[model samples]
Target: MKKLVLLLIVLVFACKNETKIIEKPIEAVKAKAKPTTKFILETLKSKGFKTFDYVDTKTKDTVIMQQYFIAFLKSGPIRNQNEEESTLLQEQHLAHLGKMYDLGYADISGPFGDDGDIRGITIYNVPTLKMADSLANSDPMVKSGRLQIEVHPWWAAKGFSLR
Candidate 1:
């Protein structure tokens, strides 16, 4: 694996109260993935994962492609009922992910809560849409009934180049 450095610049552009639509062609930047994004995905997989989707910049497919998927995972007495055991399971999962991906990571930046419910957004690299499509269906978390993960393609642009 190659060591990639991610440089992020947080730029705040003043915006009036208005809405607009913008389009960026993938072919223009398909040859390479952003350094920040590359690092993030790599670090995250190191934690644990069942499947991964390496996005094809040319295909224009991403978690942001969807409005935001709602997935009902599991948090029941019978599911990962043992915290210690669950911790081991999670560690194993991350180890597998780290071996599979280069360096994976994700950032949760915002004031949001599940209202007593546990929820979070996850991102990973995929080679294509099909890969991303299969992840949720076969996530280890889902299979073990320990985590209920769903993909919501609508990624906030804010954390794009997070360091």
Candidate 2:
């Protein structure tokens, strides 16, 4: 009985100290653990952006930066079209926007659901406000005096990108 008791204690200690590893392929493990931010950074890098670089700052610290511009579309009071004409103009406007998107002149755009004067917003990849205005003015809606644009520059830290 004493020998049986000793064997049980030895077995318990051996099992408690044992190390178990459920083997998984390294690639599988990595795929499961990969960060979304890493994928976003890689996507941004693929987009021809200088995602990470040091810049001298007034605060005596080098800073990493990324830049973009946003254009705000505001409703205009100059629409002289009836309901049917307005619908046709809207179609033309959408077609013009699709062409710009295909040309990569506009990044992303969407309309607002509010009843305010603000109509829509578009984020542009153009370098200057003049370029942004040119793109905005090229829109059929703007040319027809149905919309106006207000553009602003936006900046962010490196590795932070819209996915």
Candidate 3:
């Protein structure tokens, strides 16, 4: 009976030691893990994105700001396309916008609700105004003179979503 008790105690100690060993590695992994914000900032910087960080006084949280380009699609000189041509050009323009989103070049795009000089807007995620302008001009509507592009640099908080 005494020998059995000794064996059981030894087994318990062995189990405890194994648990401690496992717990140490888990803690080490946690300690080594980087915060998501830091990782994102580093990635953006590495990709040549212009960024700055600030602490929000209200929330006491760090906010990362990134420079993005906003392209305004305006009415161009040529607006006299035939009905079918106009429809086809519109389809091609939408397809171009979709490709931009899929390629991660453009974040969001939408047309205005009412008739206006500014027809729509596309927020480009690219780092440079030149790149954004080029992409915007590549739209079929712009290429065919149905639309014009005016690009400007805009700054916004990174990781923010439209509510």
Candidate 4:
């Protein structure tokens, strides 16, 4: 992977009783380059992904595209459920996610390693954030207060995949 240093600027404007906020990335400044990992490159190649150009709908800028919808599952305010009930809820969560995977709503779902606050993530195949939220809200973990989900929409080139 190439190292890129991006400079971001935030602009705020006030007009009468309204406020507008804008954030823009100015340019990419190259950092120290490192050798590309062969294992990762080989793994990606095995998944049938190829480089392709993608144009941002909002900015109209073109760039290489490889993306997915990432749902960040964070720790919620409620986590006082008993062990027995928590076990059952976990079962339901897995079952619900398994069904979603089988039905093609979710492409990948897993936990982050020992990360605080942020618990896990789900990569959905859906195009819009609304659809991703609908699917995420169906998780038992999210419903039972064990986790809260935040959804992000992502896009990638056609033929992108993982093993």
Best by lDDT: 3
Task: Give the per-residue lDDT of model 1 (tens digit) for 33-136.
Answer: 56564455566456433234445589764432212223333342346347877887667546544443444322221212664445333454443334444654
lDDT of 3 by residue, 55-127 (tens): 9999998999999999999999999999999999999999999999999999999999999999999999998
Off by over 4 Å in 2: 1-64, 156-163
Better of 3 and 4 by TM-score: 3
User: lDDT-based ranking, best first?
Assistant: 3, 2, 4, 1
Model 3 steric clash total? 0
> Worst 10-residue stretch by lDDT in candidate 4?
20-29
**Which candidate number maximizes TM-score?**
3
Q: Candidate 4, residues 1-163: lDDT per residue as tens digits?
A: 1222222211222332143222212122223343244444455456543334656799885545544577899998789999999999889988988998999778889888996999988887665567779899889989988899888767665444675
After TM-score superposition, the amount by which residue 8's alpha carbon in candidate 2 deviates from its true location, in angstroms, is: 64
Q: Return whichever of 2 and 3 wins on lDDT.
A: 3
Question: Could you tell me the TM-score of candidate 4?
Answer: 0.58
RMSD of each: 19.3, 8.8, 3.9, 20.2
10: Cα error in model 1, Å: 56
